[model samples]
Target: MTIRPIVRYPDPRLALPAQPVTVFDGALRELASDLLETMHAAPGIGITAPHIGISLRVVVLDLDPVDGARTYVNPEIIWASPEMILHQEGSVSMPGVNDDIRRHARVRIGYRDIDGNAQTEESGGLRAVCHQHEIDQLNGVFWIQRLSRLKRERLVKRFEKLSRG
Candidate 1:
């Protein structure tokens, strides 16, 4: 697996919705592998295809590098618990910029495995936050959208400042 370059924030591709994965084949598996390598290299717990400019409905996540990674194709959140929690969130695409964001404490999600099998699972804590965050990216919704207007504005300004430097 090769580590692919992650598209940084302000890239138009990161704001676009990803296309669904139709064929589950060797290439799909390779992409998943590459995604895992890339996400690990980013030192991030979660990453989506759009973050790397692939524009496919794929996500790879592994909170602990020693535990292996998970690939999600066409992932969709099926249910979310009423309880919410705030977690500090950052993006590989927008490194060095992060803010506490509110997310469902627990979530049930449906997705396709690399072998073309349909899979469903529930997750909580950082895993839940990661899924919700990556799913939002698949839908072209960046995490900062969950923030209030003031925070969003501040983040954008900071990104702009970084670009200038």
Candidate 2:
């Protein structure tokens, strides 16, 4: 698997919604593998196909080495808890910047596996936040959009400064 180049912040493609993966073939498996390599190279916990400009609703997450990596195809949040928690969030596309974001403390996600088998998983804590975050990305919502205007602006400025250096 190759570590594909990530589309950086402010790229118009990053703002656009990703298309759903239809054919579960070798190409889809290759894309998921590439996404895993790219996410690992980015040193991030999670990443989506959009992060590499593929525009497919594919997500690869490796929250912990012990649990191993997971590939989610066309993932969507099936349920979310009313209780919320503030957790630090960031994106592989926008490196070096993160902020506290409010997200559901627990979530149930419905997605397909690499082999196109339908599956569902319930999670809490960081995994729950990751599910919400990556699904939002597939829906064309950047993580910073969840922040207040002032906070988003400030974080963008910092990211810009970091990009420059």
Which candidate leads in TM-score? Answer: 2
For model 1, what is the C-alpha lDDT against the true structure? 0.92
lDDT of 1 by residue, 1-165 (tens): 999999988788887999999999999999999988898888788888898889899999987658688899999999999999999998999887899999999999999999989999999999999999999999999888899999999998997787688
Stretches of candidate 1 off by over 4 Å are: 163-165
Off by over 4 Å in 2: none
lDDT of 2 by residue, 1-165 (tens): 999999999998988999999999999999989999988889899999999999899999898879899999999999999999999999999999999999999999999999999999999999999999999999999999999999999999999999999
- What is residue 56's positional error in candidate 2, in angstroms? 0.8
- RMSD in Å for model 2: 0.6
- Models, CA RMSD each: 1.3, 0.6
Model 1 lDDT at residue 77? 100
lDDT of every predicted structure (CA atoms): 0.92, 0.95
Worst 10 residues of 1 by lDDT: 61-70
